[model samples]
Target: MNRLVQQMSSTPNRRRRPDPAAGEGSGAARGSNCKNITIMKLPRYGALSTRRDDVAMTTIRVHGWPVSTWTRTAAMTCIEKGAEYELVALDRFSPEHYALHPFGRMPVVEVGGLVLTETPAIACHLDECLGGPALQPEDLPTRTAMRRWMSICADYVFHDVVRAIPRGRPASAEELAVARTALERVESLVGDGPFLAGDGLTLADLFLAPQIANAREKAPEVLDGLGAIAAWAAGIEARESFRRTAYDPASV
Candidate 1:
């Protein structure tokens, strides 16, 4: 997770409930009384899905730089699950930011006192706690496949493919070879199914899409023979969650 600057531990005094009256920044309210916590206003899905009245409404605060793929992944999870959230632009080097996440990485999710450091944990929050459309599959076999793909994404796809493209200039022949192998690996894994986890969208798709997009924009030819992967990426991009979390790279 070099992209995350190597995700490290969160503050030991981590768990915190929202204080409606809390002010801005950790200094205004640290420990158990952090600032900007608000209740969620879950929308009714009519006959298809009812509003979860028993669950406490709260605003999920995602602290991260928008340009980060993982940060966008966290935010997209909120969007897809209909969780009201606020994206707090984070400068990991700041004293306050480092206080929230000791390693100074983006995507420290704060909601109703719960502080989550890892991307998967942040993305799974709503489904696990608030009760909404499941982002993870329930079937054991499919679920196992989903987890497999997610692991591949974190371990190989991002670090191998997306990170291989040189930042300021054209990728060297060796660099493009590495990226091609990574993309081809994904292409071979994605069977005839519409998504990484069979037919449904799951954490597997969410985890892989951003990295794929990054490679496409930077070194497109690495995906030359990967029509299926490109199509899958396009479908993921079409999702409203992806669009909602899209950020201008130059702005970051």
Candidate 2:
């Protein structure tokens, strides 16, 4: 929803479609960080929980719309680390965000004084710096394999699953055609182990989960027939990290 949400935010107000204000970004500061203090009265979409009663316990601040794939990916990374994040709902297309991210991607994360835009980098830093079960494998070969799958999730799975999704509708035939090879490759890989990398979950699974969920929501039949991905995603969907980051469909 990164580019699509930005496009809708830029559309003419006269259009019959609901305006981006439903995302409640209009009055948001054009270029400012959430001052270090916690401001939990969110003006836009509902907050993704960081599971702490005293929200200030975390320095993790995720500036993004809840429904955006990368945004949720960042949040999931923090959750899996057992670290809390303060979600600062901001307009993805704002010039300030473009300055921070250059590419203008959703969810510019500020944590421990570092700002990250790309999902993979954000996930890796959180996984390493924050404490929790290790998402990266210990063995050198498997770790390398884990990195390989993470790259595939970014370059290939992203195009087929998340980018292929059409707003307010399911994926079209052409989009599904583009998605076929990647989905099948995932199916073949899942048969090798319980995850994309190997026996246990890794950053590979965290990176792919939201994108796969996007495909399942928009083009479920493609996944249904590829029993392996369906089964694999089902396992991921059941995780506490995934559930904690999931946005309400109505917000989309």
Candidate 3:
């Protein structure tokens, strides 16, 4: 038997209770909190379906906390690509998390039988495989720019600036200064169009949108003087994909 198949076959069946605070229309059953929700069952490897000659149906499974920004980034990308996925919530510090991600990170994606860790890689893989509106720009120069901004968000904005705010830690003066500089840079990156990489929404937008929202919630001042960035953020936030996968602490 294949490794993934053997693993799934031997896994014990379990039930999950929906979070009560998960709001209506958010897909959480209203009364499910008091009931047992069966864990989603995946077909065995041998039983996987093929629609045409050699094309098998795509199955995406996301493992992470619903409220995690990285998790939400992967979820939003899945949504944008029109791919349906199963979200398997896991405790970040648990052995199970360490098993999937050596660094004990959230939002690992399992597609078919292949596992992909890290949000940017997962998002790009889904975009390529699923064949939707391309998330990355087609032009090489624009694509490079998009990748650059994505790196900035992951390295600087997310870690140095937005990290403390979500953890309930106050931003130190130095952190705030760094964040302000990053925001100004981001503001400058915004062109005449709404998205970060010119007119079209790219992987960079998906990567930064959650972080920007978090900043808005925890440190609105980081976005204070950036009119263009605020407008860009508003546009991204209004997207259906972002709305569906947006983080809400109350819902967690």
Measured with C-alpha atoms, the lDDT of residue 63 in candidate 3 is 93
Candidate 2 global TM-score: 0.74
Model 3, global lDDT: 0.65
RMSD of 2: 14.2
lDDT of each residue in 159-233, candidate 1, tens digit only: 888678866689999999988988887787675555777568887788888888778767778888788787778
TM-score of 1: 0.75
Find the candidate with the highest TM-score and give its number.
1
For model 3, how does the per-residue alpha-carbon lDDT over 1-252 read when each residue is reduced to its tens digit?
222223333656454342222111212222222112211223453442222221126667899876677788888888887777889988777887777787888788776445667676566656655646777666544554566666777777777667745446667777777778877877766654677664677778888888888777777777887998888788999999889876665664
* Deviating ranges (above 4 Å) for candidate 1: 1-56
Residue 100 shift from truth in candidate 2, angstroms: 2.3
Rank the models by TM-score, top first: 1, 3, 2
Write one digit per residue (lDDT tens) for candidate 2, span 5-41: 2333365545243122211122111112122122223
Pairs with backbone N, CA or C atoms under 3 Å apart (clashes), candidate 2: 21-24
Q: Model 2 has how many clashing residue pairs? A: 1
Off-target runs (Cα >4 Å) in candidate 2 are: 1-58
lDDT of 1 at 150: 63
Q: What's the lDDT for all of these models?
A: 0.65, 0.65, 0.65
